[model samples]
Target: MEAYVVATACTKFEKKPNQTFKGLTEEVYLDLLREAELENGDLIGQAWFGNCGMGTFGQRNIRGQVCFTPLVNKKLFPERVGIINVEGGCATGSMAFHGAWKDVVSGIEDVSLAIGVEKIFQPDRPDMIQEIYDGGIDQFDKDEWIKFYKDVGDQLGKPFNPEEKKGTIFMNTYGLQALWHMKKFGTTQKQIALAASKNHFHGSLNEKAQYQFKVSVEDVLNDREISYPLTRSMCAPIGDGAAAALICSKKGLKLFTKEVQDRAIKIKSSVLTGGKYRTLDEPGLSRIAAQKAFKQADIIQKDIDILEIHDATSFCEIYQLEMLGFCDDGKGGQFVEEGKTSLDGELPVNLSGGLVSKGHPVGATGLSMVHELSVQLKGEGAKRQSKRHKYALAENGGGVIGFEEAACSVIILQSPF
Candidate 1:
């Protein structure tokens, strides 16, 4: 059985200081059900809840049950619907989609629901952001990361200020890797800023984006520096949000309306893999996963009309361009600088404004990326819709283990006829 995504929805991502996880859940669930045109909740055979805010939310165990109890009525569900919890740093949402996709294709169920929800906004706590991100890395290596941050200034031949850490410790890792790219391929800060400015422009077109305002490359350069060569505008903002997707088997498509069936997106390729311990010269999970996805789908980089990459930082967009085979190894920065990834470019990326403007609620990010792709394929992207719309790709990376992401998932989606 082949799986298809008939419906997708996401809450408007923003810094909701007073919003609870339950509120986000209720909003996405109702919107998703309506979009799928399902009057009966019994159509959902199982659910996968992806989250990473248990430490801050104080519901570590039974997280899926806690959030669903108030929303999903047991009597209305399919017989003994299985509920699974998934957590993979920022890629938690994509992980949930992978689980649901497997269920639909393996004949385990005709239909399944995937939801990624997170609440990182705690106005009373100043350290909530730091504490939440630290969950993705090995807690035992806390001292090691601290020392690395303190010593990075000396290595870069500049004085390091602690306040420059405007976001999570992950920013420091991105900074160091980016600085190395600059030292090797001569990647300029302006190139990174250009990527940020483009995403900001995309955000301005998306009403649901967190930072929905046009930012020029010059504005990004003049913004507060987070880490060396990285400004505050170049980083994803902290916020809370939820996104959900309804996946169905080929046979299950008969149960939906004509409009729903016509708008469904086909899952062409789905690959998930782990990161290996690598030195400075080794490849990362993004490259490995992208290669597998393209081969599995029998598609090339240019075949993808629209794409969304996990841009935790602006420099990440440049690095991912090369890893995803959109350009040569040393030409990733130039790929963006030359407008190759803009809205009207050969390949438009992060047209939903990406994690930088879309807001990374950790768990909800993958689903948000998927949601944007689905909308664009259906010609609902409004101002950001692409002229070329045959295939879409989403690359979501999770956690920070060693030199790269601990896990990564790449999904290839085809527009439904």
Candidate 2:
């Protein structure tokens, strides 16, 4: 009754102001069925839908039913299939995937679908994007985070000023985190830029990436500054897109052709964990989630052949490298700066351009990571394919707590082909 990802599909991550919610959902829905080689949606027993903006856009309750009922009415999807809504800040997609994996592993469903769709681009109302991001942090107790940042600033001898900060508050938080890492680990701004430049190059090779052009380290360093030591190129862009995956049990796999069965990617383990207020010395939630996932998968860090992380900011890529045990506590910067994490390196990271270049549509971001890993494992990555493909890992975190993400999900996948 183990779960396996039989098929995955992702639309180009970009800003689509003219696209309606129904159109966006339908696009990925049909693509998922097509890729899974299903004659109709009736084969799916249950579904988990990930989305984070419908409530902000005015639809609150039953967001999944509201957006999906139209397809069912059109006879494109099944009316009897139950749909579960999921929202976990940026980790929304990961959470949905976790839900479906459990559904199959528990023998409750033979075939389940996990879909993540989002629309956060609004040219008419620029503030809407900010509002969407602001919700990632605690709203009722906003002052808690503000005070936390202020106290950290004093300890680092770099006082913080909210009024003077540019970009989103999350950017400022990342900027401050970068400064702390620099002070403690001798990490340089150039190393952060190197990660950005590398991802930009990887993005250039991916046709579905939002920023499909390569950028140099020098150019990334000189790009418009969002927060000190963090440029625009180092941060994720605003976008809209949808991604879907069909997770099926061993019995369910019999329904697909031999071609799909040959390309199936086994779900080794999937772990979801929460965050809490912790001091600077403590490890973040991603590390905790990763340990549980690694144990469940019965594999160590070195067993991983490739990876995709939630690099919301280039600095996060560095921090997560250390937290995820890819390297020592403070050597993430050095690891990337030395080209050990490039496409040709020992452990190829973020082959999808990551959030920085791939475009992060919060709800869809996590599944997009899943989509990339599945493609590479199946040896279908095309220009971005890695030489190694036995095992792959994805680390996705979302929102913000005192000093880390409010939620995180670590998924380990193994290639059966």
Candidate 3:
């Protein structure tokens, strides 16, 4: 059986101080059903719910049930739908999406739903934000990472300074990697700023984006420094949001209207790879995932018409451009600097502003990527839609193990048009 995305929806990626997790989930859920022209959730055979911080808020166990059971009791969701909770750090949404795709393709479920919701912003309790990100690293291996950063700093002639660190330690990690790339490939800070500026412009066109204003390259260079070479504008902001995708098999597609089926995108390939502890010379996990995904899809990197990557920082976009083989290693900086990934460039990337400006709600981010690509493929991206819309790719990474992401998922979708 082949799986297709018949419907998708996303809430604005912003901090909703008064919103609860249930509220976010409900918003996207109803919106998705409406998009699919389904009056109720009876057609959903299974569901995968992705979340990260509810555990910190004391909803540690049975998170999916806790959030969905209310709807079931209120007669919104079907009572018998099998709900599974998922977490993979920031890649939680991708993981959930992968699970639903598997359910349909494996002939286990004809229709499956994937939803990711998160509420990480706490205005009165700012420390809670730090606590959420801290969970991305190994808890027992703290000293090991500490020494690893110190060793890398010493090798680069920029000794580690805890006091100089800003945002999460992850920022420090990205800063160190950016610095190393600069030394090795002559990647300039200006190039990184250029990528940030481009995404900001793209964000300005996305009403659903958290930062919906264009930022100049010079402004990005002058923003508040988080870690050396990384400014606030270049980093993904902390926020809360929810997103959902409804996956249906060929047999299940008949349940929806022609309008929904016509716009449905085919899931050509989906690949997830685990992270490993390796040296800087080794390829990142996304590289490995992308290779497998392309091979599975029977398409090369050039076949991708649009892309959404895990751009947690501007440097991440540059690094991912290389890792995904869009450009050769050490040339990602030049690729963006030359406007190859701009909205009107060769390969439009992060037209939804990506994690940097789209707001990294962690759990919802990957599905948010799916939502944007689906919209573009359907020609529904009013302002930011690109001319090319045949194949769309999304690469989402989760956690940080060693010097790279602990888990990464790469998905390729083909346009129904």
Per-candidate Cα lDDT values, in order, are: 0.87, 0.91, 0.92
Per-residue lDDT for 318 in model 2? 94
Query: Candidate 1: where is the Cα deviation over 4 Å?
Result: 74-79, 143-164
| Candidate 2 structure quality by residue, lDDT tens digits, 1-417 | 589999999999999999977677889888888888776787788999999887778887787788788889988788888999999999999999999999999999999999999999999987788788888999998788889999998888767776664677888888888888999899999999999999999999999999999999999999999987899999999999999899999999998999888888999999999999889878999999999999999999999999999999999989999999999998999999999889999999999999999999999999999999999998989999999999999999999897899999999999886
For 1-417, candidate 1 gives per-residue lDDT tens digits of 578998999999998988888788888988998899876567888899999986576788878777787665644334466789999999899999999999999998888999999998777886876788878887886666555545654666655453555667777778777887888798999999999999999999998999889999999999998877889999998898999999999998888999899999999888898975566547788898999999988999879999999999989899988888888887889999999889999999999999999899999999999999999998899999998888999999988765688899999999984
Displacement of the residue 237 alpha carbon in candidate 1, Å: 0.4
Clashes in model 1: which pairs? Answer: none
Which of the predicted structures, 1 or 3, would earn the higher TM-score when compared with the native?
3
List of clashing residue pairs for candidate 3? none
Residue 81 lDDT (model 2): 87
In candidate 3, what are the lDDT values of residues 118-188, reduced to their tens digit? Answer: 99999998677877888899888778888888999998887776446478878888888899999999999
C-alpha lDDT of candidate 1 relative to the true structure = 0.87
Cα lDDT, model 1, residue 298: 91
Model 3 residue 311 lDDT score:
89
